[model samples]
Target chain A: MLKYLFAAFLISICLIVGKALAHYIGFFPGSIYGMLLFAAILASNIFDEAAIGAAIAKIINIMPLVFLPVCVGVIQYGDLLQTSGWKIVAVGMSSTLSVMALVAFICAKILRDERCD
Target chain B: MNAVIEPIIFCICSIAIFFSWLQFHRKFPFALFNPLLLSVISVVLILFLLEIDYSRYMTGGEWISAFIEPGVVALGYPLYKQMHLISRLWRTLIGACCLASLCALTINVLFAKALGIDEWAIRSLATLNITTAIAMETSAEIGGSAALAAVAVMIAGFTGSAFGMLLMSVLKIKNMRAVGLAFGSASHALGAATIARTSMEASAYASTALILCAIVTAIVAPIYIPFLLSL
Candidate 1:
């Protein structure tokens, strides 16, 4: 129990610092900044991965749960969906598929050639 | 529902519905049966049918939603675990991720424009290829609706998870490394997890791509999206 709390405390601190840094940098969100800072700390060996292992696992496990409300927030945009649903679907499908194909094709060519050479 | 008890009711109901769907997805193991997508649909229908005000439901929903940013921050752990692998393939991985980020942004923006999508929706659409938390925040930062961005990310993730492998087979992308990178870069975590079931090596590559692509897109989308919007 204490371990979980400590891990949460560490992450919260990172988040607060990240938000503060984001206030000045103005490029990305504080959450993302927090993620980077945490990653850097972990990479630098300041804190053992085991310290936060349980907390990280638990948080990630419920990630989809956290996203539910925001997704349901789409209810607020019914008018937008009604007017442009098909266009949104079309753009999303085509772009996602094309990006996948492009990345796969290019990476395959390069990586395979490296193996052959 | 009593006014005092309503929020708790909605919150508990949401969790119950989500867990039920999660179990169902586990049994079926089908992409179309995604727990998150199913849970969202179920909740939306429940609210609509009951004529519950979205705001009222949100009083409880906000409690769960508050964890989203912290959840994203936790993603750092997985990325950190993969640093050794990433460092070995740094050149190829970084180059592919940057290209993937650029490609996804340009295509989404240009296609949306060609389809006559409004600027606001287009901004949300532009960040669809990344993870939800980052995508939502980035979208709002760039004058888009975070809600719409979440919707767009869902669409992208669903499309990739459901059709990614089929598309790869059709396109004849045989290399597993490429497969992993494509799924990670284009589809984010959902696609990566789905592909992870088949090949651990590919999953590793996919996970690396997922984080790298998110970082790349988060940085590039601010400047590049506006330029694409202008054109």
Candidate 2:
């Protein structure tokens, strides 16, 4: 219990500092900044990995639930979807397919060459 | 329906519905039966049936949404764990992810424009290939609706998880590294998770790609999205 609280506190502090930096820099989201800061701390060994592992695991386990409210906000945009749902779906599917194809082909070619060498 | 308890009820209901769907999903293990997608549909249906205002549901819903930012920050731990792998193949990983991110943004923008999507939706679509949390943040940063961005991300994620492997096999992309990176870069976490069931090596690569592509897109979207919009 105490460990979970400590983990939360550490993450919150990182998030707060990250948001402040984002506000100052006027680019990139604070969450990403916080992510980078947290990673840096881990890399630097400022805290033991075991200390936050369980707490972070618990958080990640429920991560999908966290997006529920925001996704539900889609209900408010019914008009937008009604007007352009198919178009949006088309764009999403095509772009995803294209990107996947591009990355796969490129990696296959490059990595294959490296293996041959 | 009491105003004072409404928010709490909505929050609890959302949690219950999500966990219930999650259990079902675990047992069924079907790709299309995404717990989030199903839960959203269920909640939306209930709200519609009840004639509840979206805002009223949000009053409680925002409590769950509040955790999104922290959850994203917690993603750092997984990324950190993969640092050794990243350090070893940093060059290839970074290069592939950068290309993937830029290509995804540009293609999404072009397709949205061709489909005559509105400008705001185009911005939302710009981050479609990124994971949910980063995609929403990047979308909003670029003057798009975070909600719409979530919708777009779900679409992209679902499509990738469903068809990505088939598409790769059809394309003759058999390399595990390539397969992992492609799915991760294009489909984000959902794609990575789907790929995880097949090969542990590919799963690692997929995870690395997922995290790296997200970072790349978050950095590149702010500049590239606007530039694409202008064109």
The most accurate candidate by lDDT is 2
Q: What is the C-alpha lDDT of each candidate?
A: 0.88, 0.89
Off by over 4 Å in 2: A115-117
Assess every candidate by TM-score.
Answer: 0.95, 0.96
lDDT of 2 by residue, B95-119 (tens): 9999999999989998888888899
Residue B41's lDDT within candidate 2 is 95
lDDT of 1 by residue, B95-183 (tens): 99999999999999998899888998899879899888889888988999887898898888889999999999999999999999999
TM-score of chain A of 2: 0.89
Question: Model 2 clash pairs?
Answer: none
For all the candidates, what are their Cα RMSDs to the real structure? Answer: 2.0, 1.7
Cα lDDT tens digits for candidate 1, A1-117: 877787788789889999999899878789899999888888998777787787777767767888898889889989989999999988888888998999999999999966421
At residue B137, candidate 2 shows an lDDT of: 86
Measured against the true two-chain complex, the DockQ scores of the candidates, in the order shown, are: 0.78, 0.82
